[model samples]
Target: MDWPTAAVVIVIAVCISLLIIAALAVVVGGKAAKGLKEFDKPTTRHTF
Candidate 1:
């Protein structure tokens, strides 16, 4: 591929990777929050 085309493809790939990572982080964080709630007595879980 040409230089400009290659650069565009790389950027698109990076953006998609970032988005997937962000989604996974959200899922994991929510699970962690729920786990932490178990340690706290009497408070609402308030999970996602």
Candidate 2:
């Protein structure tokens, strides 16, 4: 294979990997945010 062809293949592989990682990050982040929201209730404070 030519250098250009190899380079293009590598670039495509890198892009696809990046896209998969980004998608997983979004999914995990959304779940984490939802969990955090569940704990966002106001807490009572006592003054001494």
Candidate 3:
């Protein structure tokens, strides 16, 4: 394979990895939010 082909493969691999990570983050975050909701209250102002 040439340099360009190698670069394209690397880029595609990175994109796929990022997508998988994002998906896992969403799943874990939803579970965490549900678990924490019972201990927290909503505020009129953004506190983050």
Q: What is the TM-score of each candidate against the true structure?
A: 0.80, 0.78, 0.74
Q: Which pairs of residues clash in candidate 1, taking residues 3 or more apart in a chain or in different chains?
A: none
Give the number of the best model, judged by TM-score.
1
Cα lDDT, all candidates: 0.88, 0.86, 0.87
Question: How many clashing pairs per prediction, in order?
Answer: 0, 0, 0
Query: Candidate 2: which pairs clash?
Result: none
Please list the Cα RMSD from the true structure of every candidate, rounded to 1 decimal place. Answer: 5.9, 4.2, 6.1
Sort the candidates on lDDT, descending order. 1, 3, 2
Model 1 lDDT per residue over 1-48, tens place: 899999999999999999999999999999999888775645554432
Q: Residue-wise lDDT of candidate 2 within 1-48, one digit each (tens)?
A: 999999999999999999999999999999999877766645422221
The C-alpha stretches of model 3 lying farther than 4 A from their native spots are 38-48
